[model samples]
Target: MNIEEYRLYCLSKKGVTESIPFSKLPNVLVFKVKGKMFTATDINTFDSFSIKCEPETIEELRLQYDALEEPPYFSKKHWSRVVVDGSISDKILYEWLDISYRLVVAKLTKKERLELEHL
Candidate 1:
């Protein structure tokens, strides 16, 4: 999928918000929930983007697909920045998005969870 499609997909999740936290890349859109980041994409150039993933599945994804550990910007143990080369299927990318959103949501405070439920 393209950058706009990817951005829309990420933002469609409950409580997810988009911002440009990385100053160096003004076009990079960081998707977060309750102030915690879960995924990101480059608006101007969809070269590659990062998503938080379960530690156990990180290696499996890397082995099975073209996914790789995120670079110096994010923790390698729990983040993988898959290159947007059109090789990875949209289904797998959506699953990664779900995983990232679930991971962040799972850490939400009880009140935050309730607020999300109301949204």
Candidate 2:
């Protein structure tokens, strides 16, 4: 999928907001709330895209989705960095992104939850 498609998909999720938190990569679009980041990508290039995933399902996803285990940047056991190049279908990619958005939203604080409810 393209950068605009990804941005719209994430924004469609409740409470999620897009920003550029990483100064190093001005083109990198970071999706977050309060302060936590759930997804991010470099709109200028499709080198990498990050998304949150369940710790237990990480390995399974890596096997099922052809994802790689890249840690330090992500939880290694939870989050994943899926390289973009048209290898995967847009439908499946959006589905995974929705899952990541929900997972991140679930961890929001009570105040944050209320704030998001208004949005």
Query: Which number leads on TM-score?
Result: 1
User: Evaluated with lDDT, which candidate comes out highest?
Assistant: 1
Give lDDT tens digits, candidate 1, residues 1-119. 88888888988888888899877878878999989999887777888888888888788878887655555578899888888877888898888889889998888999999999989
Each candidate: RMSD to true structure?
1.3, 1.8
Model 2 lDDT, full chain set: 0.79
lDDT of 2 by residue, 36-65 (tens): 788888788866688888887788778876
Collision count for each candidate, in order: 0, 0
State the C-alpha lDDT per candidate: 0.84, 0.79
> What's the C-alpha lDDT at position 70 in model 1?
59
Q: What local lDDT does model 2 show for residue 98? A: 82
Give residue 64's error in model 2 in angstroms.
Answer: 1.9
Q: Which pairs of residues collide in candidate 2?
A: none
